[model samples]
Target: MNKLTLFIIALLLSPVAVAATPIEQRMADYNPDGNLTFDAKRGEALWHQQRMVDGKQRDCNTCHGKDLTQAGKHVKTGKVIEPMAYSANKERFTKLKKVKKWFKRNCKWTYGRECTTQEKGDLLKYLSQY
Candidate 1:
């Protein structure tokens, strides 16, 4: 093969070339909001916090499990949810669209509203740590 073709092949085969890290991609979502910063501490707190949902307490941990590295089950459907930690599941937040979609769906389910960009950034920062 020619040098140019070989280079292209190598680029295609390299995992790093495939996409940005979950944290990096998540950060891009936060960048447009001037002066916003993501805090893993806040994310962790959010992860465990309970909110009133239909007159009952609900939180991300209710469905995601206390351990971010471990797989969790859907509280109502019994369906398996992949681990949220970037370390445990490299696919977690790599796609911008998928991340946005889940944040929209999950935030509403857990908090009965859309998460602010700050909340999304914080949660992603927290989850990416493990």
Candidate 2:
């Protein structure tokens, strides 16, 4: 390549890459560890515990079996989704961006609150296991 083209390439690549956002950085702190393992256990408990939603006490296991490898379909919408801990579905989590997004939505749907970092890690561990 010509020197001018090389110089332009160098200039284009010179700027330092911007860092991820604080939320992303904080989320990064959620590596699977003992704490996450513990949280996963707790998440399992929570997933099974019935709670009042729309005046109905229901739980994830009410529809999804204790084993997360089973399939679940949305009764109201008739939409099919994979088992929460299905290994066959692992490729779907290739991006952490999508992982966090789904966690936020699903946790709320199941538990009515955003999961803790440890809980998130635990869920990931449990899913990875299956």
Per-residue lDDT tens digits for candidate 1, residues 4-40, read 9999989888976657676777776777755888889
Question: Whose TM-score is greatest here?
Answer: 1
The lowest-lDDT stretch of 10 consecutive residues in candidate 1 is 16-25
Model 1's C-alpha root-mean-square deviation from the true structure amounts to 5.3
TM-score of 2: 0.60
Steric clash pairs (candidate 1): none
Assess every candidate by TM-score: 0.78, 0.60
TM-score, candidate 1, is 0.78
Model 2, C-alpha of 59: deviation from truth (Å): 2.5
